[model samples]
Target: MILLRNLVFALFFGIGSVVIVGLAPVSALFGQRAMIRHATAWTRFHHQLVRWVLGIRVAVEGERPSGPALYAAKHQAMWETLELQMRLDGAAMVLKRELADIPVWGWAALRYGAIPVDREASAAALRQMIKDARRARAQGRSVLIFPEGTRVAPGETPPLKPGFAGLYGALDMPCVPVATDSGRCWPRKGLKRPGVITLRYGAAVPPGLPRRDAEALIHAGINALERRA
Candidate 1:
């Protein structure tokens, strides 16, 4: 079932994204913002369609931060990245430097204003990311990050690197921790499975906490998921 859906998605998204990207010039020539918006619309459509076709239901747990907050999520599947784009409008994601190497998808991400970061040189990169994130917040765009840094299977916890705390410490933004069992459905290395994926939003850690304290808060957030479940 998952293979069938993936084949269908490949047939559509592969052709569709190329054609959608080709629409860029229409806006460029016409001097309109429609090109970028159209691409986002297509991506949003792809996200919704995947959920529908693969029988994966997404459930949200917990509240959205009242103000612009840094979103730290568990990395699981590609769907998580795609759905995060649609889940929050104008949201900027902190993706790997590698993703920027992709052809059409990378260009589309740049067009949509997604922020890519170098996970390897994360310490030095944090400053620039802070600037980009703040700019996005000023533009009413949320910044979502995958704190775990890499995709891991569900029913397992990956040791998180200190990137989240390092970034948050410098910027001192309100950081929101979200836990999701998305690996159960759209796992990192398997065909899609039919199941409900839970996204549990936890408290927004206050700003100005020391780096160590901030790190603990984010770690505790994931631990909370285990306790609550």
Candidate 2:
């Protein structure tokens, strides 16, 4: 039954992507704001699908930040990626260069202000990412990134990737760390289960701390839920 539900959800998700990408040019014509709205709508659709079809409920704790800031979130499953966009009202997402290179979808993502990082390029990519992130901030959008760089299992907590610190120092914005238990319900490579996925927003770490301090704070913050579990 879970398999069937997942299949149905995937089908609709694909259709939704095609429809949104197909309309990207129209949204782009109006400008970036319109494109962002279009992307937000797509994320909202994912929320709806999760609720009605997958029987999963998302519970968010603590207040979402209102102003432009950097959101460093736990990377457990793909679920939070879509949810963060909806929750942040289309904050600029930091994603892989390959994902941002995908044909029409990539074009739409760029229009929606996604910052793509070439993980293998190290220093050069970090510079480019910071530049793109600042551009997004100037546009009044928060930047969302998974500091760990890849999804982990429910109980695993990995050290954040080095680029996170570089971006944090360069952006000089309040870093809001988010914790989640989505991996328990939504596995990285398996049928998603029906359960509650909680997202807990931690206190914002102030800008300009030493790299060690910032990384320590964010690492603990984003792993809060896991620690409790």
Candidate 3:
């Protein structure tokens, strides 16, 4: 039954994704707001798929960050990726460059104002990310980044990547650290389990702090999600 359920979701996800991406040209004709709306709608649809098909419920704890801010979050599974739109409307996510290279999906992501980074992790890449992130803020879209760069298992704890700190310092906006236990139900790989996924938003770490201090705060906050679970 689990395998059948997973397959059903996988098929729906693939087709639905392509359909959403195919709307890129039409969304462009209407402008940024249209693109953002389409992106948010797509995410909401995904939320329904997991809830109804896969039986995974979602709940958000603590306060939702508002206005222009940088959201540093824990990376658990693909679930949290889609769940971001639920937390923040029209969120400009920090993603990998490879995802931007896809056919229609990549183009739609660019139109939606997502910030893509190189996996090679160079000095120039970091600089470009900061530039794009600042531009996203100027456009009035909030930013969401996975401080760990990649997803990890529920109990495993990893150091927050340096790109997070660079963006925090360069953007100079209040950083809101988010933690989630989605991986317990939606693992980074393998079988899917059914349970409630909780996203906890911590207090904002305001700007003007030293790099080390900011990094420490984000790291501790994100890892705290695991401890709570």
**Alpha-carbon lDDT, every model:** 0.72, 0.91, 0.87
Stretches of model 2 off by over 4 angstroms after superposition: none
Local error of candidate 3 at 49, Å? Answer: 0.9
Q: What is the lDDT of residue 107 in candidate 1?
A: 67
Best by TM-score: 2
| Candidate 3 lDDT tens digits, 14-123 | 89988887877798789988998888888888999999999999887788655888999888898888878655887789999999999878888898888999987799
lDDT winner between candidates 1 and 3: 3
Off by over 4 Å in 1: 24-36, 223-229
CA error at residue 149 for candidate 3, angstroms? 0.9
lDDT of 1 by residue, 1-229 (tens): 6789877767887787687676655544543235346656776877766777777788888898766778887777777777766666546888887887788667656666667788675566876777777777777767888887888766567666766766686555788887877766776665777778877788889989877777778766754555534
Clashing pairs in 2: none
The TM-score between candidate 3 and the true structure equals: 0.95
Model 2: weakest 10-residue lDDT segment is 58-67
Pick by lDDT: which candidate is best? Answer: 2
Q: In candidate 1, what residue range of length 10 has the lowest lDDT sum?
A: 27-36
- Go through the candidates in order and give the C-alpha RMSD of each one to the true structure: 2.8, 1.1, 1.3
Q: Which residue pairs collide, candidate 1?
A: none
